[model samples]
Target: MNLNFDFTEKRVIITAFFCMAFTIANLITVKVINIGFLGMETPAGVLIYPLVYILTNVIADVYGEKIAQRTIILGLCVDILFVFMTTLILFLPSPAYYTGDSSLAFVFTQTPRILVASYISYLIGNFVNARITAKVNEGKEYSSTKNLGILAFSELIDNFVFIGLAFVGVFAVTDILIMIVSHWILSLIWSAIAQPFTKMTVKWAEKGKPAEA
Candidate 1:
């Protein structure tokens, strides 16, 4: 596929990717991965989930906060639709020969508590990230580190709310807190490691075009 070089097309592409990532993350949250070195475990979805925030920040830098917020709202709607369709399919009757129904249900089923946690955390975390990133860039030029504080603060909120809601009473409070802190740190590390590349892309996209207010 040919890449679009136009700024407007780039913004659209990024927004599309943001929505896709959100949906994919939710779908994969059923799998857990062990972190041998840390003697900890986490959902496999955590690995790519951080990219959603990074892409949001990049969109905020390139297109502006209003666009970022709208894009996030769009993503939220897409996620809702995804959940609805998957749940419907999971409950639908399957043909006698269809042996994959169990696998589909296994991969797609999510408790109502988890669904709430996912939606709440996603909206709160992403909007805060976009708002802070935009506020920091007001009357100033974009920089890779400009929104570092936003990432840390908002990501912590994301993990805390998600864990507190989904796993509270299931895990000890101390263990829950540890999970939050560990996830937050890992997310920050992922974003920080991607900074240089993010900076380059933003710089290229912002050429001859000032970010919207």
Candidate 2:
């Protein structure tokens, strides 16, 4: 299989950071946080996971779709490794001196069903996001509205797929629906707040060249 290895220090740094962020988000996703708006609760991952999309858009804009897609695939591999290592740690017996074993297992024990849901949703959502971002920007000037729209739509798909698959039997249908809506809305808000930083990063990546769609 042919793969692109084109690299600069900055691109490598950004891709590595993206993978770290992805793994961290996955590890923390089991923790729910209250947003204090309408008493809504969402996975803590929502706060940081949108950065994956934001950075993907930056990559697609600057390096093209192939590189962006490659980055996503690399993130998947890293996430798999993270899961494996964590599971290994969880499966091994803890020494008598270790007091945090129970807490660690509680935090890291994700059902295989949820893991499947996460991987499927991540691949589908991220690829959709990269494709739309790349397609919209082809031979055109950068448009923030369009970028945000792509983010909104992709985030919606991601929230729906993950929540629906992971919680179908564990939660009431209404509750699952609420989770999807709440997570999507919160993710969009977070992405909007991060837009300025994203734009600045894209501009820097462009290095004096105008950004294209």
Per-residue lDDT tens digits for candidate 1, residues 141-198, read 7777666777888889899999999999899999998888878878898888888887
- How close is every model to the real structure, measured as TM-score? 0.93, 0.91
lDDT by residue for model 2 over 1-213, one digit each (tens)?
644333465688789889988888898998999889898999899879999988888888788899899999999999998889988998898789989988988988888998899888888888999999999997676777889999999889988898899989999999999999999998999998888788877767666342342
User: Pick by TM-score: which candidate is best?
Assistant: 1
Off by over 4 Å in 2: 1-7, 208-213
What does candidate 2 score on TM? 0.91
Best candidate according to lDDT: 2
As for model 1, its CA RMSD to the true structure in angstroms is 1.8
In model 1, the number of clashes is 0
lDDT of 2: 0.87
Q: How does each model score on lDDT?
A: 0.85, 0.87
Once model 1 is optimally superposed onto the true structure by TM-score, how far is the C-alpha of residue 91 displaced, in angstroms?
Answer: 2.1
